[model samples]
Target: MKTKLVLNFNPEASNLPITHNLIAEYGLLVNILRAEIDEIGGKMVIEVSGDDDSTNKGVEYLKKAGVGVRPFKEGVRRNDEICTHCGVCVSICPTSALILDHETRKVTFVEEKCVACGVCIDACPPRAMEILI
Candidate 1:
């Protein structure tokens, strides 16, 4: 099974090798989708793939280690009515979740690629991007 999570790390938790431990100790495939962290505190979105039991245990371990974890089904959504296809979000998206169709000259939101990092939410002029979780 695969699970996507948003993790909030405090100052002390930031120093820990949480990702490494999740992979090495829990035997899971860890993919860091988006991360903006500093010595203080920050947030990260990660996707982990493993068996149901391992995934659950790994999440439990994160909580025990002082990491705030929130699981979500989907990340971001775009309102087609509001989006102007300005391409501002297309350039700023780290994951290329927002794509500019050259032929249509329109911007499209590919939800599957979104990590809910929220960069496009602010960059969007129309305020079309909404965070689901």
Candidate 2:
């Protein structure tokens, strides 16, 4: 099973090796999509892959560790009517969620890979990419 999680970490929790424990102890594969940390706290968008039981257990463990866990559904929304398909977002997207289709010469958005980092929101020339957290 694959799950996207948005984690909010408090200052105290920031010092913990949470990601390491999620992998080593929980037996899950962790892919960090987006991360931001500061003196006060931080936020991270991570993709975890494991069996159903392990994934659930990992989520439970996160909650127990005082980390705010939220399910990430839609990351970036593409407004077709507004999008020019100029491929502006293709280069800026870290996850390659936005791609330029060679056959059609159009830009394609793969929502499954999107991490909702909000980079495309400002880069889209037509104002097509909207971030929904």
Candidate 3:
């Protein structure tokens, strides 16, 4: 079985000290999927994959560190009407979770490869991709 996890960082919870401690403690192999800093806030998306135990452990570690998480299902499509298909998200996706289908030419989102970093959402100019619970 495969599980897709998504972590939504709250603007109020942006604390590097706690983030660093959690990463160090849990050995979270985080790869920066996307990062942006502006007047609004700082955002970063990361993808993490491992065995079931490791993945669950990572979730637990994040929860303890006060991060928000949601499990995403595979084959779940967001509002395509709002999707722009600009390919900006495809280029910024760190784990290759979002892809452009060669046959259909539509954006394909694969949950199995998602690290829950939420970068595609930020990269999305139209804000179409949604975090499904």
Q: How high is the CA lDDT of each candidate model? A: 0.88, 0.90, 0.62
Q: Which is the better candidate, 1 or 2, if ranked by lDDT?
A: 2
lDDT of 1 by residue, 24-66 (tens): 9999999988788786897888999999999999999999999
Clashing pairs in 3: 45-117, 46-117, 47-115
Worst 10-residue lDDT window for candidate 2 reads 124-133
Candidate 2: regions farther than 4 A off: 102-104
- Which of the numbered candidates is closest to the native, going by highest TM-score? 2
Which candidate gets the maximum lDDT versus the true structure?
2
lDDT of 2 by residue, 80-115 (tens): 999988988888888898899999989989988788
RMSD of each candidate relative to the true structure: 2.8, 2.0, 5.7
